[model samples]
Target: MFATESGGVRRNSLKDFVNVKANGKIAMKLADGDKLVRVRTCTEDDDILLSAHGGKCIRFPVTGVRVFVGRDSKGVRGIKLAKGDEVIAMSVLRHVKVGVEERDEYLAAVNAARRLKGGDYTKRAEDKARDEELAAKLNEEKFVRMAEEEEYLLTIAADGLGKRSSAYEYRIAGRGGQGIANIDLARGKKKTHVAAAFTVLDSDQIVMVSDSGQIIRCSIDKISIVGRSSRGVSIFNTADGEQVVSVSRLRDVNGDDEEGDEAEEVENGGPEAEAAPQGNEEGEEEPPEVDGAGEAEGDKAGGGEEETP
Candidate 1:
């Protein structure tokens, strides 16, 4: 799967690259000034979520994109962008069939539980009783099932604020439509734009980099989970004139299987980092091998061969 910043998406089979050389082959032809933003492994049953810099996101089924037979052609539109808005991230999540009523009920229960866990004893008795009632209305088995399929989307703003929102808040819609608000852009005093938006696991760690070369790494669980359109709390504190430009998620490798562990080790170096031997016999350094495919800017096509889903 290849997703572009301009909302183009391409789906190709793994077998299509069976004979690909070390130089690599063109996975998808991109338009002028458009760059590939993601190359994640996905199944037909999964859903593709595209997040734009203007704080908008669209969710649609993977089946909405037809499997490409050639790599020279650009793919179909995954979302419609407003003027000057470009996609910042593309994430693939499991496709879960949840009704509107069920989703509302689950969210209510989850929010109530979160408030209860906060231990805010200063709340009025009626408010506490109402939260308890909402929590009790949730079916244990159904809640467990929803939890299994639930995904959290971590969205970061250029102004150093971020939050995790339930994926259920993003309703499934047809491809190539204007998306709903991903975050409240007007909630802050300073005008801000989305720096990064992608699905993350609670156990994952995130590293944020600012334009001033400042970096901050923290546990994903520390971020508060809030409504999709709500303004998030500060996750990073950028200095004056600085803005967050990049964010990366590091998976929890401790409990992974052998293959998963090896993959994570390779990913830590980055998608373009080669797995070749380090030094030569003379103890001198060797130049890294370059792939034939290149990006318009410095943005690397995310996920290398080992990361293919």
Candidate 2:
């Protein structure tokens, strides 16, 4: 017999339930991890009851709504969706919490489902093996979830290093009592393979006032924030891929923008400041957020203080 993954197994196994009826008869058996669909309901008691049974439920404005249906996909045999009982997938809710994680999970699940229906299992033994494979695939996805925190802090150690005159300078002006105690990555910040360096401007008062009121600058390179984590500011070498700075190294920087101060913010956390950070508020775009669960081995990787607001 061919291997289950060779397309022969799934197709062979589906011989039993291959012809799933999706008409108004209501014979669908929900999968083990059936997504919780939000629907309009009528009462709190009803909502709780449906949720407890793993059935989708939602309150209608104020009234708690619930739909008593089968645990499987076709729903109950005779029972049907009630008026205002809209079935919306919980996938939407999960996405709002962490789009990346939810997206990854959905992809993994879909791949597994496809593998399940691929082979032609004309025999009982083939069916058993297919089911086992599908179960294993789903079980594996339980571990690859995304995380949530998106802020970080990096230590500013270099002075006037990696300076470029071409692009505009990205300056974070210090605020009142904000004493560069630490560098904040701010939420929605993302880390990428394309690297940049943060430098502190130097002068005669370098050693003395250097601790505060000095302009802290970050040189960005790329324009993408692909696969980042939610840890606070932590620096890494652009070439060797080694982490370098951190938040505790944060110190005071120069004051916030003046009436005529003209430096621009980094665009999309990119090294090249040819353009202003997309939004008005500085690098607060879609910072790579992970809920602290999926810290990648590498290619996952921040900021300094003694800077301005």
Candidate 3:
């Protein structure tokens, strides 16, 4: 995944990395008031979603965008934004093909099972039976296997409200189009808009940074999953005047091998993998500036206010 300040898309090649390391090459040229927000490795088969603060989202196939050789070139427009709107997040989605009708039926059955398992008795017995029938039908369908491997899109608003929507909710479209809604921020309890949207798993953890410089790391499963058009429940409790500006997906650090590797890296003063902070506005803390060789220029890793992303 790659994105720029002016909502442009570009694929930076390994040659670009070699050049940047060798001669400190420019990544992508940005327009006035624009900066490169993110660059991530992704396969051509993956889908990409660019989310804006205005609650608009665009999804396009990664293979559709051409890779440019020039680093200073302004890439093609990823999404058409409304005035005063800007891109906040770009996510690489796993490709999953499921018809809308099958998905809806499968989701209904899954939700019913969840409610039933939760001991919710409000649903009628007939509803449970129908759900079971749908489940049986879905089990025989090819979509069921794809559904098991499906990914979810986590969308959080500035107010800290968010939801886990199935990646399938976002249908892939051609580039530069006004996309569909990723979250329903307008009718929510709080009058807020999207701050970030990215793909996440149930086992994943995320770090959210507030405008007040507050940071919180929490489990992704704790946040409720809702429909594409529904407003999300609050995931972070932000104080008045504070808003979540950046959210990063944390890598899984549960296994003993992973823990040992991380401990070894820390002891050796080696850099650990971390999610790059996004939408870090003016006055917000930032990662230390790195030189052409990818070494921090002035700030140490544990220095005050400056940390690795």
Candidate 4:
């Protein structure tokens, strides 16, 4: 765990974290500090610091400091700080906050997106449209980038059709970047992580990975295809058996399966035809027929051929 200080959040033990100092520690625009919740770091790892927010470590550096609760059969997860929290080694040291980094990265990205693509992420039908427009643009750009990267990961995994049988999983939940960041971590740490992920859901589903590099399913978040980006398209599974996959660019595998199954089916199912309005068989208009007499008469009238009644 860690303690928030003027310099920044410092490494702390579970036993030391107690109160929020009620004085020195400060909260910024986006951050909400538990006025009564103070923390300290122990000589140990961030576990005691973790205790402040209860055994739940979901909100790590965000919640102050944290410790790893032993992983049970259920899954890997954590909760917020505990009440009357004490079992923390709250270090009074300091570390830089990521909020600024987040803000800058998003700002730079959004500005670029606005200039390149004329989409108004800034939906300012309101009075404070200026700031609102800016924030909306930033958020949209961030989400789009996330979705595109996930698609890239999916395509790389679909190299072999033989991958349908096995799987991997991960259950990720966060308001911002934690889930994505953690997934990135797993991908790098595990062999063939990209080869195992196929469906990137907002929900967690992967479970296991073989030591050799194949993958198993975990309880990760389920990402949706509907209301999603047109990026990754391959469903993949690796023989190495690494379950969880990160949304990164192992390759520029994003594909547009535009003429996929649906397109091919429609084309092959019908005779060569132009797009036309539908109607009842009998109600449909018929093509004009030509009679031998009419053809001779028209030709004779045009002075091309003589007509024989």
Candidate 5:
């Protein structure tokens, strides 16, 4: 897995990591004031989505990043930050090919369904016109199949309000461009920005933590799924003076798989590293040394190390 820092990224090989000493080795160097914020495993085909507290986001394919021989190089810019904005979260998504018109129609259908569920089914001429246009362009059977394979993104604000939006709500863009809004903050009485946003599954649960140390867990399915720009529902009730500090997805504990088990072993200092396969057909590898000037590593930060394939 790769841990994204405010200024750069730290990465280690999954195969060779098992052979390293329990103390761990240098992964990526960083700038003096920068620190790690997020970690995610990546594949060549995966797209990286970086979210900022200012409601802007950037998406770029993983292959766009260069694989450095050493951990010392400062990583490339993943997003163009506003004057005071900084990255708070990063998510990996599978690449999907779809037309813009089709995606728009799908979102319209979802929004209409949500409106009906919320008891706002009043008829409108424009709504009818849009639906008719959508019906003529989308194949019902094909759209249903795509929806079955689609993933939804859940974004929560510090004020305890949250929403689930289709993954397609975020369009893929080049690295370092000012991104589109991840959620609407001006919809309701309270004015607050997004605290956390990540991909979620219907069967998943979420744990929201408050600034006052209060924590609440809710089923992902219970949260109202809505349009990307719509106002969200209240998923957690914070104390009068409290605000949610963080939100995380929870999966079934019994559903742990091989990768999860490996992560656990690494966390507990298990000796599976000694048994882990070493260099492939090649012999002992040399320590990598990066030549360019970039973000420099600082004093160690507190966290367990992760190795990615």
Candidate 6:
């Protein structure tokens, strides 16, 4: 799956580019000012989440897009953007069937338990009592099932504030529509924009880099999980006029594991895995090889580089 900054989405079969040479083949033809924002491997049952710099995100199923017959075509719209908004990140999430009432109940119970565990005493006595009662009514089996299927999303702002939110907070919607608020940008006095948004695991570590060349690495578990629309705590303290430009996840390495995961490939926007070249079969067209001279010329002709996400 390939997504562009202009909300275009394209899904092509892996067999389309068999026997790719040293120079990669053109995956999709982008629009005049559009650039590739994300590329991820996904299944038909998975949901695609697109996040914009304006703190808006839209989640839609992968089945919403049809497989393209050729790689040269520009795909269909994935999310509608506002006047000054552009997509920053894309993530693939598992599709789960959940009811509105069930989700509300689960969230209430979870929040109550979290507050109780943190020893929150700012609420009124009656409110605390109600929260305790709600926490006590949590269904153990249902909580366990929901926890097993839950995914956490980490969203960072350019001003260095960030938070972890449950993926369930983002409800699936139709493609080509303005999305719900991803973070609370209006709560702060200073103007801020979303720097990055992606699904992360508890054991994952993240490295953030600022435009001024400052870098900070922190454990994902240290970030506090909050409501979807709440302003997050500061994860990095940037200097004057500094802003975070990039964020990358570092997976925990397990020495005892028999099967190792593939190394992540860094691209224009973020980390993405390139499709491996497959052997050609009979009657298959061979990919054209690009000489070093032609490759440099081709890049020069491409013109206008993509902005770093």
lDDT, each prediction: 0.72, 0.22, 0.65, 0.25, 0.59, 0.73
Which digits, one per residue and each the tens of the lDDT, describe model 4 over residues 1-309? 222211112222233334668574332111233121233323321121111211111123333222222111111122222232211212111222224455455544444544444434455345345444554655576545542433211212212211211001111222111111112211354322122223233322333323344543322222212111122322334454333222221122223322212100000111111111221111112222222222221233222221110
Which regions in candidate 1 have their CA more than 4 angstroms from the true location? 119-123, 187-189, 253-309
Measured with C-alpha atoms, the lDDT of residue 127 in candidate 3 is 74
Please provide, for model 6 over 267-298, each residue's C-alpha lDDT reduced to its tens digit, 9 standing for 90 to 100: 22332221111211111122322221112222
Instruction: Give the poorly placed runs of model 5, Cα more than 4 Å off.
Output: 1-18, 116-141, 187-191, 253-309
Provide the TM-score for each candidate, comma-separated: 0.79, 0.14, 0.75, 0.19, 0.72, 0.79
Could you tell which candidate, 1 or 3, scores higher by lDDT? 1
Tens digits of per-residue lDDT for model 5, 1-309: 353434234433454245678888766556665656676778777787776665666666666454543455445555555554556677888877778887887777766554544443267767666655654433588688667768887888667888988888877765545566776666345445567888887777777788788988677899887776565888887767577776767765345331111110000111111111111111122222333332223413321121111
Writing each residue's lDDT as its tens digit, candidate 2 over 1-309 gives: 000100000001123234567664322233343332222212222111110011111111111111212222222111112222212111001112334554455444444555565645566677657565644545443333322211111122112111111001111221111111111223234322111212222210111112223333332221111111112222222233222222111223343331322221111111211111112211212233222211222323211111110
lDDT of 2: 0.22
Instruction: Give the higher-lDDT candidate: 5 or 6.
Output: 6
User: Weakest 10 consecutive residues, lDDT, candidate 3?
Assistant: 261-270
How far is 156's C-alpha from truth in model 1 (Å)? Answer: 0.7
Would you give me the overall lDDT of model 3?
0.65
* lDDT tens per residue, model 3, 1-309: 468645677765566667346557667666676766668788877888887766777788887565554566555667766566667777787766667786776677666656556644465788767666755655665756866778888888777888998776777777766667777766434456677777777877777888788888787888987787688898889997677877777665685234211110000111111212222111223333232222223524333222111
lDDT of 1 by residue, 5-87 (tens): 77677787777778889999877776678888778899989999888777788888887665655566666667766656777
User: Model 6 — TM-score against the truth?
Assistant: 0.79
Candidates in order: C-alpha RMSD to true structure = 13.4, 28.6, 12.2, 32.4, 12.0, 11.5
lDDT score at residue 4, model 4, on the 0-100 scale? 25
Q: Candidate 4: which stretches are off by over 4 Å?
A: 1-57, 62-309
